[model samples]
Target: MKLNLTTGIIPSLNVSAGLLGFFFVKTWTKFLEKTGWLKQPFTRQENTVIQTCVVASSGIAFSGGFGSYLFGMSSVVANQETNFTDALNVKNPQPAWMIGFLFVVSFIGLFSVVPLRKIMIIDFRLTYPSGTATAHLINSFHTPEGAKVAKKQVKTLGKFFSFSFLWGFFQWFFTAGNNCGFTAFPTFGLQAFNKSFYFDFSATFVGVGMICPHIINVSVLVGSILSWGIMWPLIGNKAGVWYSASLPSSSLSGLQGYKVFISIAMILGDGLYNFVKVLSRTIISLSQEIRIKRKDVLPVADQNLPASPLPSYDDERRTKLFLKDQIPIWFALGGYVTIAILAIIIVPLFFPPLKWYYILVIYIVAPVLAFCNAYGCGLTDWSLASTYGTLAIFTIGAWAGASNGGVLAGLAACGVMMNIVSTASDLSQDFKTGYLTLASPRSMFVSQVIGTAMGCLISPCVFWIFYKAFPDLGLPGSQYPAPYATVFRSMAMLGVEGFSSLPSHCLQFCYGFFFASILINAIRDSVGKKWAQYFPLPMAMAIPFYIGSYFGIDMCVGSLILFVWQKLNRAKADAFGPAVASGLICGDGIWTLPSSVLALAKVNPPICMKFLDSATNARVDAFLLGS
Candidate 1:
């Protein structure tokens, strides 16, 4: 109870309500099937679209989960300086206005990617794993040919959900907490070797590994090995800190440490090159797309975009429904323009505006970053927008200079950059989900609007509850780590001041890696994309540079599971692997709710730390639970 529900915010973030809700929604949709109130035996396409919409809308409605919708965009900055309480003597709804301001700014990126449906979904088949899994989960339940498969999925879903929920409940109540419930298998101690050896039993991550391209798995694994296993010790010894700090700390203490900052400098350098690379590719390709103006496709003069080819969807109405978009580009652009003006002029005046160029840079840099964010999302199942956000804050903050007012302005722009990248990357992935499930782009747009509206109205209230509860959200020993925000906070501070905080070794590593990334990318692009695919991704390499190698290991394990399954039973794995994986993910996500509620109410498990030795821990966990 102390570990899991100590602060009362939800414990598990990966648990999504979409798959769990699918069962109930599916049941409800079927019960009304005969009355023409629903699609009889709800088609996979319809169910997936509706479910996606619901998930997207509800999440965007509030800070429901990490990285989903109510992006802790503010969470990082909250620790820096909270707009949580109104400023002194300001009896204005400044917080409310800022929330609304951010809400409007977010739409700029969300809508920006609509033009790229052709590039992201139609041409390059990025295995957006969750999107693919959700599509499969929806299909498994509804297809007439797969009735048995669907029923089996339902049974497996229930089993997985029950087991995951009960285990998580017991784990939180009984054993340990913090990503540390029997899941991490963390007995090995803090050696780099131990870090390399650990595994994370997250089915959602494994599911992600399952659906994305095998190259991704390989690259991530290679990155983990090359960085964590090989690079750290060299960097540490070079800094002459090996005698004192044998390994990277893996916490904020790690921030000032030589290993982590060296890693950051390297990551930042490579990341900048990769950022430029992707953006250029996106621009060149997008321009080509626009110039050609493919004769088969027309610009959305009549509020419709062409549908991705969905051979499974034979219904004509599906095409009609999917093609129709309610908002026109002109209208959306006009609204965005109005909001940009308000954000730049009116809202900032309340806090006092920065220089004109500061606002101009926020407007300029944000949309440009949005382009490649889609490309990055397509390749890795991640947005890579956070990288953009961190760098943007750093660069823009450095330029804006560090007077009290300038620091505030730079931080404000950091918030904008955060929203811009997050909004673009997040919506792009969700949009891919719609495309895969053959949902209307327009309908998904509306769904996003619903989420955006809900987030605007509700997130502030939800955030206030958490902030009021734990004023120390990002401080030491606080329930909310606001881990990403720590990075943002650091960058904001440094950007305002300069790169003076980075040590000598850190600067050398940064310069070295930055150029190395540039040279590598230039060579790879010269060799053409097919050849480039073999290299470990720069972004993947960056992961283990600061964080531990466990994420790469987990993804590798997940992907390898799929690889082995493919080797053994390719057909069965292709047809049903995703369904099984989705069941695992849904199970974990759904059960987190009850466990969280239990903690919120101050319930404790029967057994706890000192009371349980290895003997008791082992038996009390599996045997007492009868599993």
Candidate 2:
């Protein structure tokens, strides 16, 4: 059973909701400040309820959106069929209560912040300040004059976001209007590919995935070296052995079985590795907890060698020792460990759960993975790490055993989930930072959640809508098989059937994992110190080349723009760049939703097709004749 919905609908609703919420919160915060009900952070106090709400909301929203993106990207890149998208339609294409159910769940999730805040930050001191954006927003409220200036800046950002939303919408409209369009002069189309040349490091996707220039340069070269430089030529001579004599009749029906298998293996392997890592660390950390007092996972005291001889396990000690010389590493380590455990136990029980270990693993291991992910990728935003952690737990829990295949399916789920969650967590941290320093938590929370939920719901709906919108030509259908979904289908293939055999493609990911691990480690070591210690090439490989390229492009452009702005007018850039980025993100929600809806509605195929043809034709004309 498959749910038939358009991707655009979710985004449209999210954007609309986010705008309203953001505006409402902003207005309320201002009114509260003016009436002396609340004093701003920069003005005096260290914290306030309103400020906390703003920052926390940012964290939640960012986590939700980025989390969904990571899961969707995993499915998209792996070309998998199963994911959050498919989950909605599992056994019920048009579930009578899905939208209503989701709305209820989301609404319940909202109140979670107020109570959770007291426990997480006030009691546990978790430093869940991944809401760096919110922190920044709070920072803006220092003085009356500064507040006015910041408010004006927010308005400006809001307008810029509007423009971005319009641009994204127009772009989507044009692209969706046709499957592929050719420009006579440039000979390019939105969906064009190079079949003759299998290796293209220069593709827009590779850049967009945030493949650092250096890594992209190396990875593509290596993959090409394997596939093109060596394997393709070998296959040319042994084509009969490698492929069937006759090509398959249906492109849609001809699933890329091997690709799906590899994707599952990657997910499983990563997930397992992370699960082990997190469980071990938390078990050791929680030696004090009554549940684990009988067993000993921690290192025996005094029996161990000096900390300097081996790797130092003490986080604070490592930090202080590296930076100043005052605080002992144990001080930071103890607090960090306590908070990690508390967060682990608390989160999944959004309503209390019977099993504490599950929540502990989700909370503790998830965030560490997120932190590692951000540092590994050079994203360097804590918010991203936190959000990534949250997503990792959810995705892995939901899909690990069901979707990932081959040996150690559970392990694979843990590993893949950890990495994905970590990345999402880091992004959330960035969002929080954006709001904390400038905006109120209430505003940030509402907008962020709306955006995230929108992304999550729309991605799957969009694909389905596209399939319906454009009836398969039966030549080469646009409805590519969902990669992860295929992996889930392959779980049965691992059975004891005589024909069953280990998936050959699964080895590629292991190869990728080992190869990337070694390569990144080497790069870090070459830099002398551990400054480059956390690179996550293995995780990057789990993602597809296109998404990786997109991330790379996104990071490069963003970092470069920030660098330039900082150099030219540090004050203005610092004051307003975040707002600009926020606006851009919000705008994406606005434009993407409606356009995707149009694509999904199955309104009129021939008419829509004609519109697409005209749009493409016009573009070609412009390119060729010079518009």
Report lDDT (CA) for all predictions: 0.54, 0.36
lDDT of 2: 0.36
Best by TM-score: 1
Could you give candidate 1's per-residue lDDT for residues 376-430 as a string of tens digits?
6666555555566566566655665554344445445555666666666666666
Residue 596, candidate 2: C-alpha displacement in angstroms: 3.4
lDDT of 2 by residue, 185-250 (tens): 112222222211222211122212221333433343343334333443453454335443243422
For each candidate, give its TM-score against the true structure: 0.69, 0.50
| TM-score of candidate 2 against the unseen true structure | 0.50
- State in Å the error of residue 526, model 2: 11
Pairing residues by index, what is the TM-score of model 1? 0.69
